[model samples]
Target: MPPPLTTTTTTFLLLITASLLLTITTSQDSDPDSDCTNKWIHIRQLPPQFNLDLLTNCSEYPLYDNFCPYTSNHGLGQKTHNNSHSWYRTDPFMLELIFHRRILEYPCLTSDPNLAKAIYLPYYSGIDSIKYLFGPEYNFSSQHGLDLFHYLSKTDTPSIWKRNFGHDHFLVMARPAWDFSQPISNDPPLFGTSFLELPQFFNVTALTLESRAYPWQEQAIPYPTSFHPPNLAYLESWINRVRRSRRNTLMLFVGGGGISANPNIRRSIRLECENSTSLSTHETGYGKLCEFVDCSNGICEHDPIKFMKPMLQASFCLQPPGDTPTRRSTFDGFLSGCIPVFFEEMSGKRQYNWHLPEAEYGEFSVFIPKEDVVFKGVRIVDVLMSIPRVEVRRMREKVLEMMPRVMYRKHGSSLGLRSKKDAFDIAIEETLQKIKSRVEEFAAQ
Candidate 1:
């Protein structure tokens, strides 16, 4: 070894080493492409009416009362005071805004459409259609629908369309697919516009909350829940809390009946809950059947804590099909780490293929057919009781693991814990892969 250096020389060498390390770390952090791979996406620069207009007219947005509070934190919604940790009550329909914002802020986003692997059309079709359809003026709905179709048809460049006939492009609708594909009959019911019916959208992939059963083009995504964590620490803490939290109730059915066209199924579920509560004194020790609120009266709790309380404290959360086959509550159940019991396939099985694990049926959730619950005289409580405690724990763990994938963290959030991929990240990856596969298939032909 060399002779020991003087104090001044040693200090200078140590400082030089530290400075070099800092420089390298700073360069990595400041690099725009550090987090992004080669998959670059191009977002169409559409008129402000498509995206920005929705936020600009937030107060006039349909269900403005519910949409306004959840607009902050990059559409992650407002924070709750009930919990010590960071939790939000983000609106499910605000996904359009979140997706648009995330794509614009994406590290892999390219201004040149020529270099993009996939094209994202940032249109607020869900809110736009809802505004016209929900209004008293029916003709406005029809005219608005016509105008949207015309706009898309006229504005699309020949070069873009010729590339793959819009196969590489995608649109994200925050509402169900049915909301945009209204029947165009002789006497069509004016429920929604026929945006999806337009020929220009035929080859395009649609990312919607609910997809049609016949067509495979529409990919089902998770409805935004109220638990957007800022970072991995918050996410892990919440998951740990859920894992350790006492589940006092055996099962919970927290929705109203009489709202749907066929309310018999919902009615049956409510009746079962009532019956189970009344018979809790018997030997089965079925525990308690908790019904948080009556959603039929349109008085359901919007508070995140109130909504999650019953789900968190319950072993199984009843997930009956809502107005659509899927309900936002399904995601809420996943967030609470409560095992969800489904009555239909579309409710969870067919939907959320991108986010959920490719596990066999009943591996992570319970699937009690509606007929079994209604016609065959099977009880929800009896089916749940049949499962072993060990199995229930396993299923809950799987659900807890899925919590991160379903969550949409704050846009431009630091990628702390590289393994923790959020909804936006997953969507972008999937979209790019899909476009690549489709392009390859076309080339092969």
Candidate 2:
């Protein structure tokens, strides 16, 4: 304070301050909650036959709906509104393609193979699973999968494949794990590519929608929901809206009317939904209205809003087991801040513990055993209304807190928002951790 500082000295001090500030800002932007791992991922852009070529013939893929429409816009489905940047008709089963698009802009992605902790194979195993079932490749063996396997086994391939003998490699499949697994005990041959069953692929970790059967190698990732927020601001605003939403519906059920193969369970649900709609004010106290979408004719009305709006107004959503024990509606309900009412343990936390490990599922979900609903004839409306109001508020708040991690960021775009980790970040972070552990456990000889 006694003497004025020289220009050179002042400039040097200023430079140091600026550098410190920049470092802080970068750290804040890169990792808001320290969920990002120090390791990087190298994405393998496989040949067209492995991914894009199969996508081109989307019709050959299996689904109840027309597959081509769902594959549009990098698996974001068709646009919903004029704002192409924010809105999309995102399909639940198109998770692999959405993850593929996200990896292109992953923050920790590295070009140098040595810098990566794990190698991502953007293989469209979902489409490939049913490709031979429909296309000219029908009756032929699953040669494409074998081709990918051979490509990885090649000596000229990246050293990442050779380092741990494919232990560090991972795949993100949109379908359930059983779709790629082989049938045992001389059972009727399951229509599969036998990809996960390959002895060479045993170490290759796969993140899938349903991992209940093969919990060791296959981890369950959240299903793709309709919403894909780019950053924290947009996501928070949506959460605020959900929080302030005057939920007028008591319960909501959106699925096929009664055409499910296991019709007895769904048939009972349909009857209850119909009965709930007719409940008198005395019978159903608060949040009296119950709504359901009879999607037997056309699932989800082919409109995201048609499905999302009901969830927004609902305090609880019915999540019965579909063809599989789990359904995308569970994620959709949570994302919309609607507490899910699950019928089976497998459909709830047992299968998707990775999605929200810290979540005490009972705090955020209502569990009514399948036997209670299907056999004992429990009333969904009465059970939902019986929960204390304070408890309902607590559950919805917990859901809002857990909501951000359930979404996949829109690729090649920026929203300039602030928030915790998203689905892509968590998936890659946990994946890299797994790969790092595997590499250390089985060091190369």
Candidate 3:
């Protein structure tokens, strides 16, 4: 049986009291004669910003669907809910910039000359021509793709049909590389190893399997919404984290971040529920869901935020990054007061990944290494299973405390991309930096 919802308010109140108690108890225990400057600072003087109003929403994006009570369910290979357009067109400039940068960073162009020359063939095509090469498979409806094609094609045209198309210049050398069907085959031939082999050719390669973390995202984009309007109101059922725990119902968050697709991390999460019967999947894969949340025909009213709140109500939120550590699961889980158990160093070494949002993890997020979960010496499931009920409750409280600021509408907060630059500036900086550094290195030689 699930924990009673009646205990929610009490749990919330107790959490507030605990924070006060912790501060008071710590001060009383401190050495009065000690030089305070070198000691830990008291909580009161630390920062006024920590005082939290737990009633606010945690999602940066507001709901764009006109309908409510969206419950959608479809079997494998079918979307599990009503496909909302809101997640289709959120940030245009950022997407375009990322794509542009990616094209410029093509691996073949940077590392192999002949292969790079062969691949750069598409970019030289007429604007209309290149647009068609992208094909319909790309998320063209998204704000990013929308802006990209607008710049590539004139006056809203969507095809590359009118443009001159040829593969002969570079293709003759690249055709062997296209045989990706046989991974065991030898590496394709190249004219030279020089970084500038095809110096002028630019095209983004297909995202590797590892890069495509959010494979299920048919249309995972955000749409524009008025900054945090005053009308937002939703009931938050505060509950003791321990008392709220449920069995078998595995909470899952499939987002872009720390746990997305590292083989080790992915392997660990599977280990946790290796024996359990409860089943849950977060919006886009990671988050908490309310008892009422479900989908019908690829459509559901599962706003990532609202969905997370209820997910906390469950036993677990299975969180894996959509692509890397910068995935939105951190923001979603932290905002909804759900405990996010993670795999270690999700963003540490992978090149070209973004950073996780700034938030205290010890109190809300859980990090474990693959070694701890895999094999007989250590099991992630065993460690997770052993965590006491009371401890989990405390973690949940920490999550709830930060909910308001995590909401997408909250301007300038860590989770929000308030201005146009907030969304795309970092990507732009990285892109230009790489281009400049690469060009200079080649020139120097």
Candidate 4:
């Protein structure tokens, strides 16, 4: 027995509450821990961008995510991309987001009728998948997530894939049959067919990164379950905001993760150096096997974190793509306040994954192809001679200008999402929906 206006207000309030519940319920349909809040996820894969301190010295920083120690479980591209190799094999974890959720490991694939039907998971992340080594019927699609291979060339044929290749949206991972002599194109010897093609194909095509398009934009996806790691370091204030003081400095990149061990993989660096510039004594002697170099100034090692700390003190960092093009060292250099000197391979070889920030390699980073490098024209040494030391320093400053957006990591603004970064949140959410929709469509068959 309320007043008429009061009754109307109550009805309106109730309606709004009901509507909110419905919305949340829909969102929770895919995310069971939607309402639960906690410190952070443990057993999380740390992004390459994370410094070694945050990764290795978990005991030093109590404020960071202590629940999850950076273990081999989070090793990048190890288990998924190189399962056949005994040395590279690692424990499997769900690549997708897990919010205090139990991870189901598909270590061995046995065709059990009761086994939940295989879910098609597309890996758009630059890191290759180890699934190929297992030789399981995989569901693959250029339509789901980011497909770097298909993005390079339109009219890329999906038909060459084997029928049991699990064409729907998944395919088994196997070594590529093609040679590295050929670059990415719509032509035959599709790299996606097997793992062997992985080494031969570098991710350096620069098609999608230059085009500013995500691989999954054309497809429909489901709402991604928030990618919370089971354990992560406690959120620190330092991580909340990127350090702004450091700008354009010398960055000597060192990469030795799972990808560096492959003999077939080697980055061709293009630096702006004088033709007469010497290969830091180390390169001349060790060449590809070069580990660390003690120069007149300091030590140069193949450790990204070590390279970052000192390199950030200088105006430019020498960023060479790792053995394969999908190497993210260049991006990592940019995050450390060091401008990348991009060395594109004239061999038409592409290295590193797509989704790289677009900027003039010369302005912020220096891009030198392998042929030019050999010719000593735009070689790292040549550029160093052409520009004054002061000018080179200024170019490094330009890289610092764009640092905030370049580095990918969990920020203070993160809403419980880990493993999946905030920068990619919207894209990942859409990707999940597309994957779900595609999966449903395939199941209908």
**Candidate whose lDDT is highest:** 2
Ranking by lDDT: 2, 1, 3, 4
**Could you tell me every candidate's TM-score relative to the true structure?**
0.84, 0.84, 0.35, 0.40
Error of 4 at 141 (Å): 16
Q: What stretches of model 3 exceed 4 Å from their correct place?
A: 1-133, 136-268, 271-274, 278-310, 321-326, 347-359, 388-390, 404-406, 410-445
For TM-score, the strongest prediction is 1
- Looking at model 3, how many pairs of residues clash? 50
lDDT of 3 by residue, 1-445 (tens): 3233223323333543554455445545555454422222111111111111111111111322211111111000112234521122112112221222222322112222221212221221111111222333122212212222333334322122112111111101111111111122224421111111121122222211122223211111211111121112211222234235443333554432233355455544444444332434432222322122332222322344435446555544545442234334444455445666665444212322422233455666566665555444464444555667678667666656644343323211232223213212333333334333444544566
Per-residue lDDT of 277-307 in model 4, one digit per residue for the tens? Answer: 3445343221221222123122221123345
Give the least accurate 10-residue stretch of model 2, judged by summed lDDT: 1-10
lDDT of 2 at 82: 71
Evaluated at residue 436, the lDDT of candidate 4 is 43
What does candidate 3 score on TM? 0.35
In what order do the candidates fall by TM-score, top score first? 1, 2, 4, 3
Model 2 lDDT per residue over 1-445, tens place: 2234334324423543454344334544564234445566666657656765555555534443456676666677777877755567877667877877666555555555565678889787877766644445444433536778777778336556776788888998888876667533224344555566667787899999887554667888888877776666677678888899878888888887455456366777777777765667664554656787766655574466777788888899888887788877788888788999888888867877766774688888899887887778777777888898899999999998888777776764454642367788788778888878888887843
